[model samples]
Target chain A: MKIAIIQFGGSNCDMDVLHIFKDILNVNAELVWYKNKDLSGYDGVVLPGGFSYGDYLRSGAIASRTPIMDSVKKIANEGKPVLGICNGFQILTEASLLDGALMTNSYPKFICDWTYLKVENNNTIFTSRFNEGEVIKIPVAHKEGNYYNTPERLNELNNNHQVAFRYVNQKGHLTNESNPNGSVENIAGITNSKGNVLGLMPHPERAAESILGSKDGLKLFLSMVDYFSNE
Target chain B: MEYYAEVTVQLKDGMLDPEGSTIKRALEHLGYSPKDVKSAKKFIITIESESIDKAKDTVDEMCRRLIANPVIHDYSIIMREA
Candidate 1:
């Protein structure tokens, strides 16, 4: 299945994602500019991490309002897999495709480090390759990744099984010290209600190869491939 | 008529404000007895409309649609004739 990596001005991680899908995974992936509104030919879409629009007006606010996001929104409504990473996650929330808002980290510093993410839900198309409660190591690089939502909405997300991942320690125990961004409930990733749209702060593309510290992130892309193949 | 509007966008109360807290802490370190610090963004906008009410509507719509995210922010607008 062909995948489209949406590229906007200042999207720095497009090539890395392209490499993981094209050279490593042997999948057909192409970088599509944000001005292109047609995504009709792709089976899935990836919004790679970077400071879009120079992170002005808010992390992803300017990029989210671009015309191409309308096309992405339509693709999401059609139930195709849509994965957003780091600043991509910020864009998803700003576009209202995801549920929560990502604010400045509690520490208020740009954190670039490896993190452990517990797979809270394996039922989603993006997380199908992971087992429930599995802990995977991925690297996160961002200044604004603190996830927030109203208490009521947070509860609803939990009840609906939309939470896809949470920050945890090496032993997979959720602790305050492990929450790099101070996100509520240590949330690191979440999927839309239909399970087709997934957004997370971690850079899975950066962790796709064993040389990159861990290859645990490859399973996420593989899960997408399996999902599209079965469809 | 041309109207100008000033919009103040701030994080809703009870939401964590890391930047604000950091500033507050710095003020304390400088020996200033500041109880708290709140941060907000102010935008000056010009809208073309026929009446004050119409300008108000346009500015409000802009704030809701783009300038502010209702999930974590609250915004207020002050409009006047330009």
Candidate 2:
């Protein structure tokens, strides 16, 4: 399937994701810049993490208003899969494609480490390869990764099972120390109402290889391939 | 006429303001007791308009569209002759 790796002005992880898709996964992916609006040719889209626009104004505020974002929304409306990682997740929320806002970390510090994430739902194409309640290790690096929303909305999202991942300990327990950025209810990832749009705070692309200390992320990419391969 | 608009954007109440909390902690460590602290952004923009009424409207739109996100932020604007 053709996937578009969207790149913004200050996006540094664009090439990293491109390498994962092109070299590691051997999938057909292209880097589409923020200004390019035509996205009808691509089957899916990936918004990788980075400090876009130097994290100006807000984490993803400026980038969400870019020209290509309208196209990203268009494809998402067409039921195409869209994966957003870290700052990409911020952009998705800022664009109102997803719910909640990623606020500054509770400690107000930039944290970078491998975090354990429990697969909260395996029903979606993004997490179907993994078993329900499975735990995977992925790296997260950001200061504004703390997720926040109204209590009513958070309850609604949880009731709908839209929460895709949650921070947990190595033993798969939700402990206070396991939550690195103090995200609400230990939420690490979520999907939109349609389940075609996913926004995750961790960098799965950074952990897709064994040499990088984990291959857990490979299943996620493979799941994407498996999804369209069936179609 | 030229008007300068000053906009203050702040996180809404009941939202966790981590940056503000950190600052509050530092102040407490310095022996100052503060009930709480809230951080905000002040944006000053100069608008070219025919009247003060029009300048206020322009700055208000700018805050709504760009400077402030209605989801988590509330902003107020002040205008004066440049």
Candidate 3:
């Protein structure tokens, strides 16, 4: 399946994700510039991480308003898979494609470290390869990754099984120490109610190779491929 | 009419302001007792419209659409003749 990895200005991780998709996953993936608004040809889209627009105004504010997001949204609404990572997740929230917002971390420091993610739901196309409650290693690097939403809305997300992943400890337990960012409910990722769109703060692309410390991230991309193949 | 609209965007009440809290702690270390702290952003925008009411509407829409994220922020706009 052909995947469009949309690249915005200042997006540094575009190449890395492109390499993973092409070299590791053996998939046909291309780096599509943000100005290229046509995504109809691609089977899936990925918004890679970086300081788009130099993170002016907010982490993903300026980039979310760009013309390319319209095409991204159009494809997402068509039930095509869309994966947003790190700053990409911020853009999805800013674009209102996903629920909640990624706010400044509670420590208010630029955090770069590895984190354990407990797969809260595995029913989606993005997580079908994983088992519910399975824990995986991923890396996160950002200053604004604290996910926030109103209490009622959070409950709605939980009830709807939209929370796809959450921060956890080695023993698969949720704790304050495990929560690198003070996200409400220690959330690290979430999916849209339809389960076609997934957004997360961690850099799964960085962890896709064993040499990079973990190959746990490969399953996420593989899951998408499996979905497309099944269709 | 040319109008200047000053928009203030702040996190909604009960939302934690980590930067503000860190600053508050620093102030305490300096022997100053502070109840709490909050951080906000201010944007001064100039808009040309037919009337003051229209200018207010434009500024308000800007805040709603761009300047503020309704999920966690509240914004206020003050319009005056430019």
**Clash counts for the predictions, in order:** 0, 0, 0
Q: For residues B1-82, could you state the per-residue lDDT of candidate 2 as single tens digits?
A: 9999999999999788888988899999999999999999999999899999999998898888879988789999989999
Tell me the TM-score of candidate 3's A chain. 0.99
- Cα RMSD of predicted structure 1: 0.8
Instruction: Give the per-residue lDDT digits (tens) of candidate 3, residues A3-66.
Output: 9999999898899989988998789999999988888889999999999999888889999999
Q: What is the C-alpha lDDT of each candidate?
A: 0.94, 0.93, 0.93
- DockQ value for model 3: 0.89
* The candidate that achieves the highest DockQ relative to the unseen native structure: 1
To one decimal place, how large is model 1's interface RMSD in Å? 0.6
Clashing pairs in 3: none
Clashes of 1: 0
| TM-score versus the correct structure, for each prediction | 0.98, 0.96, 0.98
RMSD of each: 0.8, 1.4, 1.0
Q: Please give, for residues A54-127, the per-residue lDDT of candidate 1 as tens digits.
A: 99999999999999999999999999999999999999999999998999999999999999999999998999
What are the per-residue Cα lDDT tens digits for candidate 2 across A1-231?
899999988888999889988998789999998888999889999999999999999999999999899999999999999999999999999999999999889888899999999999998979989999999999999999998888899999999899999999999999889999889899999999999999999998989999999989888888888899998
User: What is the full ranking by lDDT, best candidate first?
Assistant: 1, 3, 2
